[model samples]
Target: MTHLDDTESDDIGTLLGADGPFARELPNFAPRLAQQAMARAVQQAIAGRDTLIAEAGTGTGKTFAYLVPALLSGERVIISTGTKTLQDQLYFRDLPKVRSVLGARLKTALLKGRANYLCLYRLDQTVREGATFERTQAAQLATIRAWSARTRRGDRMELAEVPEESPLWPRVTSTPENCLGVECPFFEDCHVVKARREALEADVVVVNHHLLFADLALKQEGFGEILPGAAAFILDEAHQIPELAGQFFSQSISARQLTDMAKDVLTECTGITGAIGLLLEPVEALQDALRKLRLALEPLPTRGAFQLLEDRADVRASLHELRELLATLEELLASQAERSRGFANLRERAELFTERLERIVESHGDQDVRWYETFPRGFALYATPLDLAVPMRGLRERTHAAWIHTSATLSVAGNFDHFARQLGLDDPRTLSLGSPFDYARQGLCYLPPDLPDPNARDYTEQVIESVLPVLHASNGRAFLLFTSHRALRRAAELLQDKVPWPLFVQGTAPRPRLLEEFRASGHGVLLGAASFWEGVDVVGEALSVVVIDKLPFAAPDDPVLMARLAALEQSGINPFMGWQVPSAVIALKQGAGRLIRDVHDRGVLVLCDPRLTSKGYGRLFLASLPPMPRTRALADVQVFFANALSPDARDGGEGRAGV
Candidate 1:
């Protein structure tokens, strides 16, 4: 726990009240009672050292509500966000404004995942070896080189002109298995180490959930972690914690990882050192084995558990052969004439890979779920734990700090039990605030009728047809969020030439760029998948409608989901009724939340899935949404838009026809 001064100062209400610091500091500030109330509750939670789960609705000024108390509390704090975008916003925008207004000497630092920082050693290695890149990437690498000379933080985001999916990024950045740590030649000038030092000295440290979980994993393993001295913990966008925690708790080893390690070792042998003659044949053999292993995996399904994969004779044989080769390579590296750092790194990686594969093959317990997932490049075998409650509890015990978990959609139908159970929070006080926006006047829920089931082959086409009238009424400032990538692509193709507005697809550019294009175009239809469902905000005129093609539901056949359901069934629970329905309801709530981002913002919510109305569980979805005007007719949607956008309408510029 942080040392407490115990000097009470201005109350949360006074700081956030009308004519308070905000009203005095910012000209556009509006007083929101719900925001003020949430701020007070957060302060109380922090002061009392209690656990709190809060759901502050859209337009609640939730960021300020939490940040104000956090800054004034005088405790060393670690604020974790769900995404990098939000992390940047807090570090760059929100925190500064609050500090200036309060005149508090609050020092803040921003830290990201390891990959976000450049590895001076890796970049030097690439340059020393004269590695070749594709033409476009070569140009980008030149730019990176120019920037590296001037970059103070060595953060990739500093290269704003570089595309997010640039192929050169992975080559320059370091991963856990590849990083040489303190043994690196460039240790003193390490960007990651320097960032950690700065973070530890600051009053507030900002990080994303991935890095935070990495810290937690290290703590669990009794290793050094990155977070500064922290007492209170604030998790914004708390709904994402469950899925992310599942990933961090799992152990994964991919064929591509092995292949990359082999290439790195070979490069070290041939480029940096003069061990090419001794290692060339064995390295080639390892590379061939890895390639054959990738080929063997190509026959399996895109994703499934190792149990299902074991039926493939080719894959099993390849895995066995790869294991044998890894063992032999480890022995061969062990016998190297000079025990160089490169040789030591390769041997360690080889041993770790062998251990992970052995675990994937032999690991079996009610506690762990082993699976394999195939991507465009390669397949990864995972041994993810089915249960996280025990680990979560351990984290809480270790931190010994107040925990405040807050998000816009943490509950389903006013119930936080699902989230609480997943997080293993013990009877935490819960708060659920409806959006301060007048939903009755600011939004309309449109459920189109006579649409085919979501599983139907032509449902994407039907969804297009159903929302055409609304898009026409609103002039195409909308987000068409799909549950699947295939559906999103299909919808994009069907609407390519039909809609009068410019169309933007998710994969055309980075998500931030697509959103910028959407906002800058003034009116465009953005087609996206699950990634667009949450943490996206477009206020006023640029976003007027959110179209969800179907209820967001995880595939039951997913290996992890299957294992979870099996675990629940063993405990005499119905997976769908108890867990699946509530989870979908929470997701549907997040989609609905994309509409009405502010007090006066008016928009329409279009859900094309007939199950939202046809199924018995549909009521659960409806109950989870804000209290608003609900209609099934396209005519009502058209009417709402026409009235909202009409120049004569009273609310025309009062944040109508927008988010």
Candidate 2:
């Protein structure tokens, strides 16, 4: 066992006081297994020679477990979360409570991406440009203007009622691509800069994974360090890190950004005379040509693999034409005109695009990665991911203090190979803590007998039929987890009339509101995909059944997924074992975890996927879950739910019996 050093012991001893901000006595609260795990993590972090991968189970009070060690150690720590919601939770709620309780008046700050903070220069520019605003947007701007006058923090979350998707958000926000940085007239008043300055001074900093990865990508280039060289770094929700890192490591130039750059330039250069316009005409012509090329590619069938510019000669010819156009644009930019900014921006875009295109053309059939992605609305584009493992390694190295990475399902059974390999870490100190809940006594994993294949057309109907009786037995308290949104919608429609519970679809009332209603209504059944998996905490009888429609496989047709699979195959790895199976196992563990959140929580889990029963690979997935009582009979599930939903049920009172 690792002993707390003098500094750690002193900090903890001081905090366990009668007059401290702690609402409860620390010793009275039973010590948790997570505390031991966290203690070891702190030791490892202080040593700064090894990495740690810890899978602290639910009910571990995992947040406070790591926070205590981090605070007591007195190190500059950076905490990166998977979602903005968690970031807000940590910054606004968790940190303050911990500080007050611990009697540690340590400075702390919350920093988010530039997009989350209002860019005063951009806001002023948008208002001055007389940009047309929709009625709702105009009202939002008026509200923001009023709030901006009184607000001190300038954090967007301070605004009481801002919708996440408000058009006003982007109008007031800035991106790295569009930001003029220190050169801006409003640089001193910049919210992003102010937040960063606060973070630099703070002992602890909270940020989301996206911003953390962005800073890593930009670190050598000297933009800004979101996750600075900290004494300790704790990455909560570490499961999502790989995919997010993939995005950060990839190069993407969006159409919207390109168009925005052009518009900004046009606005900046509007009052310039004729010679500049004539010279800049070629820049516009080149943009139009590139736009037409993208338009042509849009209608093609959605297929795997990046589309390289066919024929090196054709690509070279286009490059020559673009070069000539940019040369003219440079000449216009050199002229002392009001539109110089526009010309300069055009020139920048040309140079950037040419470089990206050259890389794409040269990377075909090479180890260098290239791929295409299309939006739901049908706009298609290309990307090239830089070496991912490098930034991942960089993050692990920079976080100097204790780093504890936890998730509900960080391993496949007991092996951490899949998750470890993805994070580019090899067998760092690893631990897997089992859930305190006794799944063998309280819950049952039910797989219906003789079900049709999950990929068949009639699978949705079969799944709904299989779970309706259990839903009826439990009187609603169920979540129908689907592999896809389409399946979720279909099952929701079919089960609407058949089940006794009032159904809540995922998108109907927003996630938090729907969950609130589910708890309030009591007889509530929710059907959702993806987001329904984890971070859902419904204890007691309110959630007594979890019906997973099928194995949650990453969509095979997703262009990025396909590309990754191809790359894996070329490396002589089984895509299923190395990629697809592990991903599904993690997701399934998330869904299954929702059922038995607390000790008193008892539920029936119905996995409708036949593959779990028929294939040898299924054992790996099963071993990843809680040690639940397994059942194949629908009758057994009905009985289990009946007992779970009853008020008189007594096996797991106060949520500790399951343990």
Candidate 3:
């Protein structure tokens, strides 16, 4: 048996030497600050005493840093991430290399959420239902079905070119609402179960924030936990945890549930014998009541939990009406010609909706925090908080393990308190690792001295004017990140006709396609919203300038932000300092992070929001960026760009100190 203990005293540098497997396996690999962080992190994990929040800067080689320690510690570890791309990256690319180099002494597993795995039973049901499948999707389904026959690894990411919103995806995936679990026909061969079993057996389990938060929520109700008793729980991309945790912590039921019930009634209205319409009478009544509920809530903010009908009389009356009607429908369907045929679907849907509504009504009031969601040209719902902090704290307390939460933008102005307070972590060991890149020589921070206030009319026009020059200097190898989609659209309109380069906007093509076109078309200037702020990798000269329209503060009118800030204010906290500013700081960092992804990458981060140089709060945003050459003068920016592209760009004459 492989001994489960601390790694033998060995220099990590030696392990990373020229003759070592790491050298042979990864050509561009070398010792990183992350390696040292990992050694300390591993020792802390073993000690099991305190939480560690270590910031491994961009290109600090953080993934391998944590992975090496997690592997060498010889204990069960669960690594969670914010994105599926990184999750798959760790599982498929990084994990294998680590195992091979370490002589395969450790076992690891990649576990995705249920939605990513195909539910054989559901797939079969969908096929039986004769749902006319799209041609390409049908082909992909056939491929997945064939591959499912012999494959042991059940990751959906293995299937290439499967767009996230493919219609076939929903038909094949599982949700807790529809999952029959062990009672399903294909339960024995369930991909989710198989993956979970592997996870339970492995020394390390890789998961994303959604899955981890789900497991935490599940444990509250005595549902199964995903990660076993592990020595450490390392949450990467920890910046995203709070928002996701808020979601898992909240409860929601949508008007769509009632709509689906009405559709079910319609489906069962025909082809059945006795009293089909009568049986569906209560369902129809329930649908009408739900419509009334939606109308009653029409006056409220489009999103957030609010009590539209105070005193529970209207809602209780509706529930009573629904319950009585459902009973009649059940009795009518019981006497139908085909007893079980054509009846089960509607019955199941009705029963589920009723149960969810009952839960909502029963849990309403201040005891359970309540809210309503309004979507623009989309579905809306009413929701309540399902105790977010409890589960999160449970995960923290039970693990009794040294947990490390790291991100490039974790702290705002050298203070980790904002995220720490939200996550219920107190004074965790923290460090701010400056980016290792030579930012002074490679990058410029351009804050336009004169611009209209970000909130004023013609703000976007001014932003475009300020940034268009930088784009010209770089010949349009730029990413323009806007605070809102409306502004993005406005800026795109302003630049489309005037700019002397190919401009790609976010919604014009899908995000990946836009990024592709931007990278390929050398005159690349891509304008995008939130998705473009972070996780966009455009190394080298292909992305030479990132123009941010403004400091990316959460919209004051956003329901969640308003609600959260209100809650903070009620508790006697400065909402701006406690919530808004820190959030914006993190977001600004994400936008600025796009500027220099590699050592060879040289660029300017031009903020059209003069707040970075004008406002007192600007210092917070400024301090959060890489230690780069800052500039405000138009002349300085022009000179810097000229020097950057000149033959002597690398020779580095001190262009301008602080602009």
Top TM-score: which candidate number? Answer: 1
TM-score of every prediction relative to native: 0.95, 0.87, 0.87
Q: How much is 66 displaced in model 2, in angstroms?
A: 1.0
Candidate 1's error at 496, in angstroms?
Answer: 2.3
Expressed as tens digits, the lDDT of each residue in 1-659 for candidate 1 is 22223333336767787879898888888888888878877887787777899999888888899889899889888899999888998999999998898888977899887789888888888877776777898888889889888999998988887777887788899887788777899999988888887787888889888888877865321124545357688999999998989988888888788888878877777654557777778778877887787777776778887786688888888888878888888787777625677777777888888888888788877688888887786778898888788888888888778889999999988999999988889799899888877888888988888998777888888889888988998888999999999989898889988988999999888888899999999789999898889988888778989999988889765898888888888899888877898889888888888877877678889988888778899888898899988998878887787676555564345435441
Record all residue pairs in model 3 with backbone atoms less than 3 Å apart, i.e. clashing: 302-374, 303-374, 304-372, 305-371, 305-372, 306-371, 306-372, 631-659, 632-659
**lDDT (C-alpha, whole model) for all candidates:** 0.83, 0.71, 0.72
List the lowest-lDDT window of 10 residues for candidate 3.
1-10
**Candidate 2 displacement at residue 250 in angstroms:** 0.9
Task: Return the TM-score for candidate 2, rounded to 2 decimals.
Answer: 0.87
Best candidate (score: lDDT): 1
Number of clashes in every candidate structure? 0, 8, 9
Please tell me which model should have the higher TM-score, number 2 or number 3: 2
- Model 2, position 92: C-alpha lDDT score: 85
TM-score, cand. 1? 0.95
- Please list the residue runs of candidate 1 whose C-alpha ends up more than 4 Å from where it truly belongs after superposition: 1-10, 219-228, 271-274, 645-659
lDDT of 2 by residue, 109-158 (tens): 88888788888887787778776778888888888888877777677878
